[model samples]
Target: MEANRVDHLLLHFFVIVVGLTAILGKLIELPADQLVAWRTLAAAVVMGLVFYRVRFFRQPRKVILSYLGAGGVLGLHWLALYGAIKVSNVTVAVAGLSSAALFTALVEPVITGRRHSKLEVAIGGVVMIGLGLIVGFASEFGLGLVLGVTSALLAAIFPSMNKRFVDQGGNPLVITFHEMVGAFVVCAAVVLGRGEPVHMPTASDWLWLGVLVVLCTVFAFWMHTWLLRRMSAYTAALALSFEPVYAMVLAALFFGEHKMFSPWFYLGVVIIVLANWCYPVARKRQAMRQSAE
Candidate 1:
């Protein structure tokens, strides 16, 4: 039980890391597309070293393609997510992304070919209410809101793919390694096609980029992989859902007066967090009852 508690705590920390990724993107003054291209490139380098150490790169072609698919999702997710930060402030971008679990609820059933669970839908609806509040308070929605939502939907695709790939005997580390590479390739192609030189980031830009790659991308994903091994998937996903709450708090702390939204914003966040946190618990209970029945 104590081990479970620790795993739970670590997953929550992962949420914070992802949430704060937007802050890093906002602080660095670069085009969102270019930023994602560099981030994917950096993450690929880190994953490559890990790949060599694990010797997981020796896998067959089919397995490698699976990694590329996952990576494609990863690339698109970052592209949209960073684009959200570019078009809007970090507060609105993060708030909009809080709807990820709602997206997941809908996508998971279709992908897994399982009957849609009522509890999951209910929880998703609740989270939507929370998003409504956040958007209500921050009424200056723009292209960023649409991009943020798309980013989140793309993010939902990867986790389920992770589970499927692992279940099919794919190497987790290799999957991550190749996915990062795939993301880098896709982003680079997009950046280059834009007919602009890859914006050469300065020392300070590199510094913040390192923080994002090391702390958020590398460490966060590694911790999440570790937690997945120790805890149930539902528990892991539920804890991960707190990303918006964690992000919003950090935005307020870092941005101070500027990040502060109206009272409606706080209320919306509360509603969303409540929905995200409650969804898994409800799912777990339903599973237990089914077992007994």
Candidate 2:
């Protein structure tokens, strides 16, 4: 952890920005699909200027399609996440999303052909338990919880696949650029097919969308890609487990969401966050045991 102090700090900052997405999502009036479509479309448009000089067409066709496919997964993930938010509050949506750490423990091994880490899997279970405690047996959040977990599944997958791509010498910025374009296409198609009204954003919506595109999508997307170069996908996903904490806190501040939970909420928050912070220790012990054996 000390060795990668900078990466850890940057990851926290990224989580903060990601948490803000829920706040913005709640603020925006568009349906979930439309919000995702607009965000992806606007992000691609802005990011094009950054990588326009690159010869994307000359790049490998298979690589382009692969990144695009991953981006499609990303599009669906965002929609599910925002859908959860629309159906329920930010706490319910984010708490369910925290399970991505566990899903990554399961998925990353299968996707990357890596051996499963018992410690990581165990930590992932703890994350799920913590999430359950936070959400409790509240039947009201059932649909939202389901969608949030679905979001977690997709969220775990693409980053692992993207890490494989990045390791195979894919340029992170270019990959993100292609993926955003792909997300926009997938989301736009869905929006059009649903016959949802695609009216232009009003002034307030534009302000929120602008913040979302420039900060949350463009800057955050690039930063996420950059972080991948320095860390494993599982580590990244584990760190993201802390997203709910930031989101819960932000929701409290912005939406007065604190009163909605029981006393178990604080305990659950502590447990989930401790799971993330425990990663470095768990990883070191796993390596030591492996080497000794």
Candidate 3:
């Protein structure tokens, strides 16, 4: 029981760190593609150093290639997220991420070849309703909302893909490292193809990027993969639903994102948050009744 409590605490902390990605994405004055490229490169370099002794080559070629593909998708996910932030404000970008839970519900079963949970589908519907409300109020940020939703879809895909690889006995850290490499390669190609010069970061940008790569990407992602070994992906998705809450509060505090939305928009956010919070409880009760029967 005590261990469970500690794990939950750590999980929330992980979400908080993940929440800061948007803030860092906004603070770094680079295009989304370039930012993702550099961040992934930094993470790959750090992770490589940390796990230098591990023989990643010993892994089958198939596994290595899978991680690379997933990493490419993950890079696209980050690009969409930062792109949203650049086109809109932090609040809209983060709020749109809340839709990831809905996407996961829709995508996971398809990927895993499992039956879809009716309750999850219903909950996803509720989440979509909430998102529709937010988008309705913030129509000016339409492009941002679309990009953010696209990121959510990719977010669902990569994690579900990772879960499959991990089930096949892939080391979480190694998968993460390779994924970073894949992201770096893909982003670099995209940036170069666009005819964009890679801009060097200022000292302050370096500091922020360091925090983002080390704390947010590396640590948070490692912890997420670790936790997935013990918990259902549904539980993890529920917890991640709070990420928008954390990001929104931080954005308000740091970037004055509070002024960007109306009370109705906040109402929509509250509805989405409440649905996530209640889902686990509802699932637990259903399980209890099934056991009793």
The lDDT leader among the candidates is: 2
**Per-residue C-alpha lDDT of model 2 across residues 203-243, encoded as one tens digit per residue:** 89899999999999889978887888888889889888888
Choose 1 or 3, whichever is better by lDDT: 3
Q: For residue 269, what is the lDDT in candidate 1? A: 76
> For candidate 1, which ten residues in a row score worst on lDDT?
228-237
Clashes of 2: 0
Q: Which residue pairs collide, candidate 1?
A: none
lDDT tens digits, residues 188-293, model 1?
A: 8889888987788889899999999888887777666555555433345555567767766777778762445688887887887787666657767898999999
Candidate 1 ranges beyond 4 A from true positions: 1-3, 229-235, 257-260
**Ten consecutive residues with minimal summed lDDT in candidate 3?**
1-10
CA lDDT, every prediction?
A: 0.75, 0.88, 0.86
Q: Hey, what RMSD does candidate 1 come out at?
A: 2.4
Worst 10 residues of 2 by lDDT: 1-10
TM-scores, all candidates, are 0.90, 0.95, 0.96
Model 3, range 4-116, lDDT digits (tens) per residue? 76787888898899999999998999899999999999999998888899776678888899999999999999989999999997889877888888888888888766678
